[model samples]
Target: MPTIASSNFPTPKSWDEFEDICLSVIKVKCKSTNFNRYGRAGQKQNGVDITGKDHFGFSIGVQCKNTLNLLTEKIIEDEIVKAESFAPRLSTLYIATTRPPDAPLQSFIQKI
Candidate 1:
């Protein structure tokens, strides 16, 4: 996880906080604040943590991975597969994490 540069305190205190940070990122990236957390903890969210439309009204989705280790290709692929069930379909699905990329995202899902 990314650390706070000023306070030295962890940027996110919990998994939910991590998701919130990712949600904010999605908002800024899409230039839209219309996104929201997808579902409650333990619910079947189809691998999406936060989802909504972008400024252009294209369906956008985000999956926050608060992994302790490097984010792996397999994990991303799994999430991409699960995201297929999301309603209205997604024009873009962003995987939010601090780790470096392990593999090409386009192989698992289109426009991700």
Candidate 2:
């Protein structure tokens, strides 16, 4: 099984390694759901760890944080902003972390 890692979270690793984990998770999730998906790593124009199109043809932007620690609201906000900047072109934005966010951060994400 693939896993995510980060300096701030669990075990720190290179960005490329984290990117790989993110891509793996997306692939597994999409495959399990029988969704046709396509992905790219660090595509310059995308400004995200991974970008993909689902079975329904909607574009998605994903940011992965490998840290074991809880994700912060600011980090989520920044990723959202980055996703929005790439918007209408991308239908949904997702921030995936190795560890879940704190209660406050989770609430913030729900509102975003």
Candidate 3:
């Protein structure tokens, strides 16, 4: 795979399309990625966009944010908190954003 900084992945046309890309990525990276029933935009999603079991059968939650603006600490933190309240619970929470996390945000996530 190409380095994330220089990845050739095409930009998604919309937020929903970005979520689909994230789901596809999760499927390729794992073996059991599943899109939530409420994954569609404008749905009453409880926070998670995708859910799946890891190789160890641990549930994982994915939230995708497709935006050109840089991510903020508050946004990332909020997503983490929301994922925590999702049903069935998740062993991990992932935020797939168009822009990579800044250093501070990355550190914060690593410390979680």
Candidate 4:
């Protein structure tokens, strides 16, 4: 995980903050896996959070949700489908969230 700058302590309170957290996570994971990290540009019409590319030149998409409730598998499935529609060549798709998803949702992510 990217170290939260000391000046940036305290949990995020908004969608943009949540998006920043997800982007940080993605950057760290990509770097650790030897993949290049690109930042999110804008929100998708269907609310996808970020879009970029990995080291292998494969397009990547990330959707972020910050909520207290556990995420549903349908949300993940829908985000993946939406991302595919936006970037058909995407090799990796992720629905990143602040709250850990429920068991079934986690399993769905694992399968993806």
Instruction: Give the whole-model CA lDDT for all candidates, comma-separated.
Output: 0.80, 0.65, 0.75, 0.64
TM-score of each: 0.78, 0.66, 0.81, 0.68
> 94 in model 1: Cα distance from truth in Å?
0.6
Please report the candidate that would top lDDT against the real structure: 1
Backbone clashes in model 4, listed as residue pairs: none
The best-first sequence of candidates by lDDT reads 1, 3, 2, 4
- Tell me how far the alpha carbon of residue 73 in candidate 1 is from the true structure, in angstroms, after superposition: 1.3
TM-score for candidate 3, residues paired by index = 0.81
Better of 2 and 4 by TM-score: 4
lDDT of 2 by residue, 1-112 (tens): 5455433444437656777667777767655333222345545444466777766767776777777675687777766776677744778777777675478777788887
Give candidate 2 regions above 4 Å deviation: 1-12, 32-47
lDDT of 2 at 61: 69
Give the number of colliding residue pairs in candidate 1: 0
Error of 4 at 68 (Å): 1.7
Best candidate according to TM-score: 3
lDDT per residue for candidate 1 within 1-112, as digits (tens), equals 5654443435466788899888887889889989999999989999899999999999998998776565666788888899988997998888877553344553544434
Off by over 4 Å in 4: 1-11, 32-43
